[model samples]
Target: MREFLQRTLVWLIVILFIGLAFWAFSGPIEGLIAAGVALLAWLGFHLYHIALLLRWLEQPTAERVPDGFGAWHTVFMTLYRTMRSQMQSKRKLTNVLERFINAGEAMPDGVVVLDENDRIEWINPMAMEHLNLDRKHDVGNQILNLIRQPSFHAYMKNASFSQPLVLQLTQPRELVISVQLVPFDSTRKLLLSRDITSLERVQTVHRDFVANVSHELRTPLTVVGGFLETLSDMEEVDQATLSHFLPMMMEQSRRMQSLVEDLLTLSRLENSPKAVMAEKVNMQDMLDTLMVEAEGLSQGRHHVRLEKGCNQWLWGSAQELHSAFGNLVSNAVRYTPEGGDIVLSWKAEGERLCFSVKDSGIGIPREHIPRLTERFYRVDRGRSRGNGGTGLGLAIVKHVVARHNARLDIRSEPDKGSTFSVIFQRERSAEPEAQPENQA
Candidate 1:
């Protein structure tokens, strides 16, 4: 309002000056004629300035503001400054928006922005993968139409986002995705999704492990309790009956002891951050001791042979390797029949050195081969228990091999035979160092 008044005052002063100059120059008639001419000239000048202002307004970005005299000059400068300030602010906002988008793209979890109608406005790459969505083509499409899971549709309609929904997809692989929606602004929604399949598997394994441990312990405890009750109840039992019962009790006690020891070994292997012992282990000597132990376990049932094909000794914890190799030999003796052949071979295949136990035992089915290393996972539970197997031998072997950067391979066919091989990398194999007699 002040600017308007100032402009009005300036125009009035110009008119008054023209009147006074005409009055001072000539008489009333001449003065009036001159005044009319002067007013026309002023009108033409103002008209030209109006045309420039109109052109500037039409293309403010293309044309610069017109330089004007007096109040017109002030008006042009004010509009120009305001427009420039607004442009600068808009540029800053655009830069900030671009940075926000980049950060969202880099996130591990999926992020999706939706409008009031649940139409996908924008989605990151992770969302594209999780939902199998094509951002380029599927944008502006309703999320419900694409991800047509019944649970997700129901959840969307309910508009309750306090909890997340887990969606299981079975197309490419068995994937578990956790999804949640957050309402922001007035009608905008933000959808978040994360792959939680690994977490879910771990939880399942933990539950199964606890249940298996309980089941294993319960059987032994029940047997021990029943026998103790029987012995206490029968005060005058015969010597032969007592001797049979005592051996049975001792066998169950030994089984329990073995189970407990294996569980402890597993616990220690998991808890230890790194291998504790680093020494040159003589593979030939290790196999020699293992053969002796295997023979005792076999009780002249299976023909055991040791074929040392490689002189490359192992460099690692001797105790861990022994426990691993010993388990393989023992398992072979336990599983192989009376006349079956068990061949323990240590040889170099290419750059990898392998210690394998091949047995002509009751072979495993194809379906059960993948889970052989799992704790307490047996192909035949009754047969394993009858053979005095604690079900944790292969699980221990797996951990030991992993610690030494080795791989365990199992090849088997039902009714044929099975071969279990532990392949160690060449870097892990070392030449046996010479002993110095002076120290002795």
Candidate 2:
């Protein structure tokens, strides 16, 4: 108020000065005219400066204020400085906002921002993948309306969000999602989602593994325990009966031993970070050893043949490759009928070298083919037991192939025999001439 009064007083004094000066030269009427003209000129000067300021405000830039207005020039400069400061602050805030959005986009989990009314305000890229949301179209739509899951709706509606909600979505595919909400900025909410399908699968596998191990051990233990009780109860058991019972007990013990050994092999393969070291493995030598082992396992029950024409050497762990190759050959021999033919072949197909075990035995059903590599999975449990199989053969083979960066391909149809092939990467295979004779 004081500044306003001071400005008004100054303007009035300037007009009075003009009036007095005109009065000294002329009469009072002329002086009044001169004062009015002077006042009009000053008003026009201020109006011109104000117009420039308004124009600059509409589209501001780093340009100097227009001059020639005297006192008004100072005011214009002050306004320019204030505007420049505001622009700098706005640029800084925009940079920070962009960084925040980029960090959210890089995250694996999904993030979403919602208004007080549960309407989506913004979402990251991962949120689009997890929730199948269109960022542009989904904005302003209620989150509950889009998700529409009962568990999620109930959790969102509840007053407290103490725990996260797990939901299974079956749209794009089967997916398990864990969703949680956080209250922020007073009424606004931040929602987070994570895909837990793999974790859930691991948990289920662990449970089944424990139960299977217990069941496999329990059956043999019961058999051995019952036989021991019978022997202890009899005072004078006949020699023939004792011999028969002892052989059966030994067979049961051997079965248990094989199961334990397979379990150990699987555990070792699962825990190892990588192959110990990659060396040139002679495929011919490896196949020779497999043929001998297959013959022993077959016991003349099946005809086994080997057709070798691969590069002769592959770069990988010798033990691991041997184990993997031996498993496939032995499985073929075990499954083949007494008169059926089992063919083991190593040949180059395209860029890959394939080690295949083809058998003319009972083929696998289409439904069970996918899970043939699973531990303790058998098409016929009684048949596998009678053939002295521990059911962990294919599982071990799978791990070995993975360690060597190879692929396991199975083609089978029920009653038409089955073919199992391990296709090694071409990069890992070497020609006989490329490797030294000693190394080969």
Candidate 3:
């Protein structure tokens, strides 16, 4: 409005000046003619500016706004300011959206976005992996169609978001996922998925451990209770009967005691902080003691020999190493057949010091090797029990090895032999003359 008024005012001034000048030299009719000519020229000037405005409007950028004379100058400047402000606001919004997408991609858990009609809108990389979805092809498709699990379909249909659903997916990999749906904006929903396979495995192990413990205790308890009941019911126990049952009861009682002790040792190793490596263990003396224990356990059934390749001492808890090594030797002694060769060695290979037990025993199958360190796991349950094993030796050995920063390697072939080795890093072993600083 202001520009229009300004132009009108200028036009009137031009007409008046031209009219008066012509009137002074000529007549009123000639003055009227001059005013009309001035009006035409003024219109032409306005038309030129109008054309420039139209050309600039096609692109309508701040940088391309045309400069104008008189009122059009104000019009062009206003357009420039407005256009620049809008561009800045748009750039900020774009940055914010980019940051949001980047955060979604970086998240560890899977995130899937659904539209009002339950169509796939956006999904993070983790979501793509968890759902086995191709982002290019899966986007804009119905989420239910892609995930056709009946439970998941029912979960979506029910719209109950209070509890998460546990889904076992077999595509891409066998995965146990805990999924939850969250509603937002009165129309859209967020589907969140978390991998819980490890958690499920732990729970299963816990249940199995409880059952095994109960079963182990029940057998001994039943034996001891039955013998006691029989002795109590007798009026006068004969000498032959007493002799027959007493030793058997004592053996079962000892077995139970051993099991309890092993359980305590394993629990301590697992719960305690890393073992103190301050004590310097004499490897030669330790191996000799293990030789004596192996002979005592074998009772001339197997030939046990010690091989000391290096007399280097180790920097670790002597008691823990003794227990770990003793378990290995005892296992070898018990498993080997009569006259079988059982070798216990403290040797160096490359940059490591290894204490290994090799035996000519009925070796374990390949399938059982991976789970040998699991508590109470056995290749043959009856044979292991007959040999008086608590089934916690390897588990204890594993914990001890981990505490000492060592690795346990097991190699075996059926009917050939088996070797169990605990390999320690070079830093753990030192010569007699140069021992490491005590790090208690």
Candidate 4:
């Protein structure tokens, strides 16, 4: 629209020039012509004045802002250079500004604009959302004062254009913010923040896992070595002495064994998508074998009760289901005292198959039951040692159940014993072809 007006003014100025020339050259011809020419000259001069105003409006910013002295003069030179650059490229200044603003808005990271007084001048939508900023109250507030974090304030207070301040948002979100201390004019600063919560979480879990695993292994290893040395140099190698120390040795060895197995299982489970299973399994036969093994392991005092709710042919990994079912039954027996009973049962719940092993042993506390599947977690450390438990039994069961697209649920009270269940998402439970024994 301004371009059109500018061209119109130029045309008006041209018409005025023609009229002025006619009045000045045709003077002796006619009074009416002379009067007409005078009127045209007056209109032309005014139109020319209008042209000057249009030209001023049309001038580049570098030309419009008059040159000042000293440092101010340097700004004009820089502005002139920018103006020349823009002109050389034949780009619209308004378009450039629009693109810049659009890019700022489109950024995924949070961005903030600060004025000379270090107050937040403007913030992008991401900044508002990521920082949980209240647009109503946050704007016009000092960035340093409002964000009360010492890290942020210090960054702002001691920032240089050469070095950007990168800090984490101290808020619960723990967002990673990389702030560019872009100094525009004497006081404005631009801050950019990107959320790294997920990344930080993954890194933290990795660190914890490494530290925990290392700590868990170190103690057992020290015991195993220390006891070996003591056993070797003992003067009296009698049955009574051997009996006392042998059990402790076995306990330490077993604990180490359990830790190693768990480490291996965890490693294997964490591998690629080939963690697969597709086979026919008779859960009854599987549970029966598991029962037999559990009884043998516990010496027959564990009376296991079995009830089948599905005779359908289950399809999945035979080994994984076996391990999962075995873990549930074995774990039940392990926690159950000598005379306690373990009940192995299964059913088809809607479209999914559920296999359960319940016990009449010492039950798990409500709090401890939640972490029952965590690697190396134990309800009673003493009881776990007495039972020769690796604490990876449930963890193994969990990963197996997950591979089968199933979920494991544990229900227990502090003293009434516990019921560990694996809800199989597979379509059906496999039936035993021959009469498979169920007395593990």
Which structure among the candidates has the greatest lDDT? 3
Q: What is the lDDT of residue 331 in candidate 1?
A: 90
Best by TM-score: 1
Model 4, CA-based lDDT: 0.72
lDDT of 3 at 317: 92
Q: Write the per-residue lDDT of candidate 2 for residues 1-440, one digit (tens) a residue.
A: 35445665798799989998998899899899999998988788778878887877677774655553466656766666777888799899999998998998899999999999999999998888888899989999999999988888899989898788898998677888898999999999999999999999999888988888888888888999999999999898999988989988998899899999899889999998877435878787788899999999988888889998755588888888888888898888888888999999999988889999999999999999999999888899989878888889999999999988899999998877999999988787866545576865
Tens-digit lDDT string for candidate 3 (339-433): 89999988999989999999999999999999999999999999999999989999999999999999999999998889999999998986765
Candidate 1: tens digits of C-alpha lDDT, residues 1-440: 47856776776677767777777887666767766777777678778888989988888952387888766777778888888888899999999999999999999999999999999999999989888889899999999999999999999988579999999987556789999999999999999999999999999989989998898888888998998898889878899988988888888888899999999999999889756436889887788899999999988888999898978888888999999989998898888888999999999999999999999999999999989999999999999988988899999999999999899999998877899999998889898666568832
Model 4, runs deviating above 4 Å: 1-108, 160-187, 232-247, 367-370, 426-440
TM-score for all models, in order of appearance: 0.91, 0.90, 0.89, 0.69
lDDT of 3: 0.91
RMSD, model 3, all Cα superposed? Answer: 3.9
Steric clashes per prediction = 0, 0, 0, 5
The global C-alpha lDDT for each of the candidates, from Candidate 1 onward, is 0.88, 0.87, 0.91, 0.72
Instruction: Indicate the worst ten consecutive residues by lDDT in candidate 1.
Output: 431-440
